[model samples]
Target: MAGTSDPLTPRAKLAVTAGKAVAAASRAAGRGSGSVIGGRVALKLDPDLLARLAQNLDVTLVSATNGKTTTTRLIAEALKAAGPVVSNALGANMPAGITSALAGGSESKFGVIEVDEKYLAGVARDTDPKCIALLNLSRDQLDRAAETRMLAENWREGLAGTKAVIVANCDDPLVVWAASSSPNVIWVAAGQMWKDDAWSCPSCGGVMQRPGDDWFCGECGFRRPTPSWVLSGDHVLDPHGSAWPIHLQLPGRANKANAASSAAVAAVFGVPPQVALERMYQVQAVAGRYDVVQFQERDLRLLLAKNPAGWLETFSLIDPPPTPVILSVNARGADGTDTSWLWDVDYTRLTGHPIFVLGDRKLDLAVRLEVANQHFQVCDSLDQAVQMCPPGRIEVIANYTAFQDLRRRVGN
Candidate 1:
């Protein structure tokens, strides 16, 4: 069992020990990360294991449709600069995975946790975090995770009276509405590129009016809150109107927005913006996303775009025109069961790049690209897809499971 200042109950100690054994066995067997499965067994023995493990730690919960893992990693890095920090850095956001991580890092002074949007309320209740960062919400894995508005309302209802300071994205109307219930909130103008989900106000189900960058509901009075932290082009301005130059090893504007959010959350832990951003610069990738893998005589830079909003951001991160791009999609359990979300993205953005599509849902993606008047070659595997392109450096963008599949294949 992990060493903690607060002594664990006899059952809790036994549970933690059993869980560690299972996780070690799992890793040795080449099964998986083993965090979730280990935590599950621990929780079965002691249902309150997560809460017990997190009780003595200063925890920060990060929830979003996208960028949760990366933001969590950034906050952890900033917090690590201050002192010891713990995090589930392997893209696991559920209670089970979180518990396993907490148990492993029992003596860490701070904890940065990534939580799924649907499970934010429950995890927050158990962790009693110092703060909760709410990133933008969009339609993702809709089959299992309810609609965006419904998830927002869940956040609203579940977090009505809690004391966790909410660090929320003001540009996202849904996030604004959800965080509205919490009085102690630091609104951040982290830009939202996907507006389809926010055009309808979550407040009164009325039309939302967006005149330029500002947004307000026409029918209801709910409007965008004034932000204390803003992410302007290549810069982040703090509340005092001082600009912090955003220079990150991670590519793309979306990651810059993530950095801005992380700086805000780190401030609660007494970390200054300059210090936070300076430490965050050390993070080059989250999990395997944005990491380059050498495969079949080509350098394939991996990018994970799990939804329409994610795809929009991914298009900006890849190499320029004439560079070959490989796109993959899967409707596995981790990904949503429905492939209908493929139609939401505008595939025409890849018009100039030599595009190759593969995965379990390659046919579905092919049909969507056809409808968008985009040219794409449908192949059966990553190797086949790369062979279709004459590539020295190729780009590969995949959704949840598909990204993991290729990450494993290349041993990256």
Candidate 2:
């Protein structure tokens, strides 16, 4: 509505109309990616549609290697208490997707956007977000994103011009380095479980010392920033040292860290921590990250893990040994072509559990499991995999394309 009011010229309005028509046609034709197409059309016509639409709006941009979608949803849900909120709920996180979301919700004055890691700086600069949440950074989409350190440097440079309040994860050294230059930063020690990607100091390139949960560089004396918000046990510790219990429908400690970061962002907008936590508890599933779908006689709990770091975190959320699990891996564009990251995952933890592997890269996963000495059966289809599992709940953990395939097959 910011751009739709009187600020937009007649030509801009016409471009918006044409883009909307194309999006509508795309949806009717059964192509689910209408948003990106629409945004592309609008941008091609005007070129500055995103910046125009973002003017004068209160924006919060959420970015991370993982958990961007779910964390953005949680932040959007909490922000809804203040008023109507706009967000990219469908997980189209690039410039075009973000432009489409803003164009669709033109009337809303507040927005929470999930930004792709590579596009974080550009999106933040264009949107001029009031609060920018910097979640943990790790090795992701190596084919396109190059190196994690380079991505952090891009973020550091991109955010140097913004006046936005920065809420960052102190547990991740990369996040700390990226946000260190921000004039106004609120550090949160939202637990970091995976350390394989961050063994060395990002600042001095020295060996990082991790005495406990806190990390520091022994060479240049670059240490983890003292956090104002921290996830301790089952509660989130506020700046005042008061603890607030976290009760979420979403599983894993990763989600808890996400909730803590969301709460911190909400607090920047004057949203009470209690209200934020209460609203977070109501989030049953984010896109298809934690959805349970019934396939034939079996109920499958879906968990999406795109890389080694993600797999490590997701594996901890399992119900433990004796619980039957299905693992799906794909080498499609969305899942990244390199299936070598599978070997980096600690599959030995899954040894005692009954594992069923299925996907385009099922054989690749099968080999990895066999090398790890984990007992697993390879199924050609989801139905066969579901039937192979013991009666009751079956946990299905998959990469990008495989996860989407499962969601579509089960009608989730």
Candidate 3:
């Protein structure tokens, strides 16, 4: 509010006040997480609360089927060097969550929001963001998000009229197709590790060719766009062909790609490359992602993999066999009631490793692992599972609900 000169309408002001009151009461009563109910009340009072609050703010929106949270955290961390920055860092990435974050950070002129893939179009249109980062498109929440191609088409239609500069991942064909029509686009080859969801060309419905890291559609002649910014091994290359070293505490090549995307986005906002990389290195974790917690004398490194594509990336980051790992799965509402996605993951990667299956869907995972000829033991108690592992650091890979439960047990 302090950064903007635009005055809020009386009705909008009343809506904001009522929303804040409801949020306060909800927190005091301990009935909800206090993230969405406040925004819900505000929207109920004034249906256009989001567009009003978003006015006169420079916003960068990050949306993807995966890595949106961590990538958003990286971008927000880097952009803070410019000035005061506000973000929805809690991983509540919907209309309600976005409204709550905007209301909470009313004094900041810059906003970095992580939006859900399904709701990206509406949020982007409402916020009129300065830049939109499109990470990748993959199968996620099949019950809710209809199809990957359909989502991309929706994004293409939603962003057709926006004037914001689009920063897109060129390595992903679906992403390329979605942002191709944008008048101002900056392509970054952030590297797409999971290709199971994009085996077919989004343009001509032809079989896509993946020769090494590059991809092309032979029938339609649609290929991976030549990127302006490329993420090579341990380095990010600029348009001038100069490379800068990237060092991040977050593990795996996926995080390196996230850093590259953040650096590209930061550059568009006038933040230097070196300065962005330096700021990103200081980020230890993002919303409990890749965070180490001590549980029962064992230091457990938590990794959240909600779907097959996420599992594929997480598996590639894990250390080779002989390392003790815990695999937890759940079929809760937040975890997507359908547990069929578990079968889509390649569990043979952990064949030789000692795996302890936990969570409500442990039996389901155990059966799948058995079919894949992977040896694993079932543990009813997480404490017992930890005790079974050797001393020192242990890896814990969990889905949505299981990961949240573990985070709660670890007390942050």
Candidate 4:
């Protein structure tokens, strides 16, 4: 019986009001953004809070192992071409954080949510999104998150029978399988870099035949669907063969791929490709992913590389040889305690750069670098690493919690 026309009950209204107050207090105390704790408080007071708050809006949920925060940001900005949009812009993807975002912007006409891969189905069911964008899946947080195939199967079951039109990357075999249950799918050719996790077919336990960009299961006859939207270099070609240029302030091919996906999601909500690209071009940073700051009079560009796949993409984005590269890592719960994924990364690619490692788990990274025969210094502090380097343009690459710690230390 709950509908957009239904106003929040007195109890739900009180919960929203209380959540807002707690959120404000937390922000004032400088504890953190307070999205999670505030949402938790609200949900405890009213279990049906998220569903009620999203009733009036057209929701679009985005999920992936990597590029999630950045993709969610791009989608939210592009959707602004439609009207006011409510989004959890600070990378909070859980139900509690989602409840906080929706309650905060109760009157917004649309909602763009970035969900952790594990919780995508639950959020989709609760929000009943008009569309869902599935980017690509790779190994991430092995200790805390589900394996790629299992998660993709979870997505397949969770999204089945939902009326939401799925915009998925056909280049990823697992994503293709995940979106298979949905009748209405808008396949996009967003490239996948890490093939280690998806070498086998999720449908039949057979080896996947990946011949360049196209992948298929010879055993089960599962194949990559033809993508209506294709990303070629910096240009995105639409179904009509109209190539649109993405004038993004964010760097790297990964972000350009995100733009293509964002455009597709925006189009589902009636926003034109040109208009969406215009709005997306204005976003320079997503929670400091590509933020440049001054440290010891040097310009340090911040890049986040959490897992092996993410690290590979990030390697391509760093400045050319001899430019000092500071690599920071953490084995905290957020970054996944198993540091074994480090060995999977081709650290030899970092050979030419003057490398420095500093983090709670720098020792793990140092050992990996040593085994790869790549020269790097282990610094006790981020400032020490920066001071060791000469003049301008230092690259600071860190995983999740380390990135947060560096940002907080930089007073961002």
Candidate 5:
């Protein structure tokens, strides 16, 4: 549906009509399902419709394996701080999602959407964003995504002739390679935390050099550009109380990269470094991913892991895993119907045996956890899992659908 049409205006009109009908039906059903994109079924929509919807608005498109939501939110916040802005806050990153987000703010000056890596090119070709933020690529959703190299190819093809201000994470070779052909681009290196797992130099097939904190290719002398703003030192603090001064309101090593990437993009909008840094300190965490909740006398942490990279990063941050945890796995359409990506996650990091495992695929997760040498108490319902979970230091790992189900059950 995305590439078939000639003019986007007619397709957009049709999409709006369809969306309104669905929204009304969902409302009548007493469900908020209408806010979500691609929640019903995996029918591809025309990109022309998305292009027509973004015709008048200045658009900022963000794509990454991880941290796109946080980075998108921060970019939107920074832009809104300067003036009025519109965004799809629902975390829908597809063509229909782009349309849905635009449906909310028909008169806003700018539009920001966190796009999925696979659909980014179609969305870009359709939306024609004025600015594009290319973040790092990691192993995520391997089953659905094929592999990282394939995702990179999709990204490259989708972004051609975007005519947008390309803001890229220079440390990521794939991101850099994607932006190399772009006419106007600004490279933002993640000063201290830049990590590369590339096997050989794309340019010369030589080994890479890790000098100090940054990395460089040995043969071609290719290296990441110096950051526009470096978030160095040990103190990287986020909104949460500072255990580590370099506090990322989000958890894991990937989040620090996300924060730094957001700051780099914010600099493009003339947000002073200090002001942006201060704002980062005050920004609230996004829901479903490292969102901390309080229940009566219990402290609950909800981390979303729809893909392998996300799960691994979340696993890494949750160091010295909490005792008696809850792992929720689901295969609902919204949470990715295929749950095979579980093979990529390192469940071993969750050393302590979970007290409860919940989901449509609870046993599947239980088996995975068991293979990682952890024991689990499997439950069919989320409520049962929460009821069985102890009060202090409780953690929940959920996919998108399970999170929604768990939130509804727990009254969050």
Candidate 6:
């Protein structure tokens, strides 16, 4: 027999190296490992790290274009409602970030992780989660993801063989179609989540129909059952206003969808609906993604607008502009390196006079806003933008790269 070498010995070295590398690069980049920003060095590690880490724990992986971070955090909290658990709740949804998170809590029994769409297959194959949540597919990170259709196809291919208890959002047609093809699937829907951005039929190119509050393939008449756990009006005590004594502590229609999905998935694992709702209500915002901050006497709400889907959702929350919005756009290689994705975002909905556009690429943001015939004041620096804005109610839309810049400059 070969001499016994400690199996954990090699992993210990890898873990130390991974942690040091993540910490060093993040420090150099003026960010932290668990923050909404992705670490520069975490992507350098092999994708198998998360899979290796998952071998030691019972894990649940959540993936989607939007509502992922919230859903991931919600599920983790829901599970925690039943008992103690560990999670990678920093909004770092890729394989490496999940690795870093799991490595940080190597001793925990349940590891709930949020994963990006692109890395779903790789992480799923490696980690083999006990449960998985596939939220809706939407136009997100167009430059990086190319398109939502491509993401849907990738997800279908990736999740074909996974033995996870799949919790899927059935409201989105694409998600419903994908989940229908999968075995052992549970559906979660957001009834009347948003009617304005209704998707057209993929096959016939006709307007998709919503009959009896349930979406269907308009052309083909491929009617699917309404989700078992639809968000009823009664379930949502407050859709827009915050803190109305609902099941979930968070507000926003989008947050309701996220909470619904998390509740559905938790219920699949024997967590009672009442218990899940109670735990979800205890959940709060994760850092700057939707974190409300009081800085320089201004009540600022920070939201991540990495792609069109996120921007659209954020748009629905705040009142029509002239609210002195702070729009930040930055160009870095890691943050898609190209600002072309900005065009995909619907800039028409946002109408404001002299909006404060700041960051490394403030001029680009200004130009984009100007083309839309919206008033935007270009700032030489983020500090100037902060100085220009008054306290009490400011909305800041920061892209992936812009968020890092904002944190350093605005103390948000």
Best by lDDT: 4
TM-score of 2: 0.97
lDDT of each: 0.90, 0.88, 0.89, 0.91, 0.67, 0.69
Structure candidate 1, residue pairs in collision: none
Better of 2 and 5 by lDDT: 2
| Candidate 1: tens digits of C-alpha lDDT, residues 49-71 | 88888887888999999899999
Clashes of 3: 1
**How does each model score on TM-score?**
0.98, 0.97, 0.97, 0.98, 0.81, 0.82
Of 4 and 5, the candidate ranking higher by lDDT: 4
Query: What lDDT, from 0 to 1, does candidate 5 have?
Result: 0.67
Question: Lowest-lDDT window of 10 residues in candidate 3?
Answer: 1-10
Ranking by lDDT: 4, 1, 3, 2, 6, 5
Model 6: weakest 10-residue lDDT segment is 236-245
* Least well predicted 10-residue stretch by lDDT in candidate 4: 1-10
Candidate 2 stretches greater than 4 Å from native? 1-5
Clashing pairs in 4: none
Name the better of 1 and 3 by lDDT. 1
Tens digits of per-residue lDDT for model 6 on 305-376? 776667777777775656778888877765665776566667777775347888787777777787788767
Clashing pairs in 6: 248-281
TM-score for candidate 6, please give it.
0.82
Q: Cα miss at 412, model 2 (Å)?
A: 1.0
List the lowest-lDDT window of 10 residues for candidate 2.
1-10
Q: Is candidate 3 or 6 superior in TM-score?
A: 3
Q: How big is the positional error of residue 193 in model 5, measured in Å on the Cα after superposition?
A: 8.3
List model 3 lDDT by residue over 178-258, tens digit each.
998788999999988788889999998999999998899999899998899999999999888889899999999999999
